[model samples]
Target: MKALDIRVMWFQRALHLWLLVWLLSALPAAEWLWEHPVSPELGDPGIVSGLLHGFGVWMPSGAAVPVAIALLLFAVIGAFKSRPWWIGALTWLFFCALTDRAWLANNGGTWLMRNALFWSIFLRVDPSKEHGPLSLVPIQVLRLQLLLAYAITGLQKLHGTTWTDGTALGIIASDPTYGPSLLPVTPGLCWAVLLFQLTFPLAVWWGPTRIVWLAAGVVFHLGTAFWLGIVDMAFAFLVFYLLWFPEEGVAWMMRSLRITSTANTT
Candidate 1:
């Protein structure tokens, strides 16, 4: 096969593997909720570990992150844009962002902007290279991850008993584990959760409606953090969720990457 074909094959293989991972997660995600169970049972705690557990996604590429970065290095050395190296880098970045969320990485506004930067990065990608084509893979995959997370979160509310009535917020407001611990939310908070929960799935569809609800979502998650006064994790998830937006231009994104990339060119 030609080198380009080989690169395409590699990218396809990586995309397939990522999708398979996502597909396999459904049952396990639901089951894990029962087994590990991060409460609130609806809204994201906004932290990385809490968001990962609640979303049923395993982030924190862990030791795997460096390996992925190494692959990114090798891919760049050899110029293998078609090889899903970008996908690997994104997965790693997602994990790294998750870590930031877990520890309350920065001061209040600082973390918000920090995560927003990551969110913007998530939307951007570089696909122009002679060695390999920049498929729309990254943008699509990032959105898929966000949509999947929203679906699962919505599922939690739909399936849970506490969510059906107003009591879910009340129950969590009392629990601290399910909701924020710093300051408890009011029964009024449940209404906010309910509105967002009802609209979450709709936020994924393509259109102006998506942005509207998505903005509402940011407001909603931020509200949860502020009201409950637990900001970090919640903000990270929202920042991560912003990965769904459209990329302005792949060429610019990649050129920017070239300037910023730490790896050496072969």
Candidate 2:
């Protein structure tokens, strides 16, 4: 029962930040549609658009920009407010936008962001109140979901000759579309990433290694983003790291900040 009194501020802030980044990163796509107009390849939103259209909601050809802007504002306000319902509503709307056939521009990371937002709706937003871990079920579910993603990806990689031989990164680095011109992807680095992903869940469960594993995760994801030119996807992955961030750590950080501020005021 003692462990149930978890504080949610860290998760809230992380969700807010992720939403902001996701919205901001989406701006360029929105801008492109605003300038080019909707077409099958450029702006075919997705399944959500089809469903909505069936219901008589005709999403205009060039509405992506305004929709993204509104979601961006929602995220900005969420950073300072405790309106979980508003966040949830806006997130659902954004998901609908993402599903538009003309807006077929998403990846695994984007899906992760959407699921995280869906779960965050159930998190308590008031920092002053203590909530049960049971009430924080969404956070736990997200952690499991992320771990499963890592495990499944690692297991899948194991079946690949390139990953086993450590030539997988080299292969990716050679890809013309997503490859980095400057950064070199070596066998050692590829193996390190594979091992890290395979062991991440266990490391987090071990307590002492959780912070180290998370730090390493940040480095790995950032490196991937740099090499793949998928910065937004990296941001989405990093946002979930907050789930493992401990309540004690956040409380201590808040106390230290408060003490520093008070000393400066004196």
If scored against the real structure, what TM-score would every candidate get? 0.43, 0.79
Best by lDDT: 2
Q: Give the per-residue lDDT of model 2 (tens digit) for 122-157.
A: 776443345566765876787788798889899999
Residue 89's lDDT within candidate 1 is 47
Error of 2 at 169 (Å): 0.7
At residue 163, candidate 2 shows an lDDT of: 88
Please identify model 1 stretches exceeding 4 Å from their true place. Answer: 1-124, 127-134, 176-192, 246-266
| Alpha-carbon deviation at 197 in model 2, angstroms | 0.8
RMSD of each: 14.2, 5.6
- lDDT, candidate 1, equals 0.45
What lDDT, from 0 to 1, does candidate 2 have? Answer: 0.66
Query: What is the Cα-based TM-score of model 2?
Result: 0.79
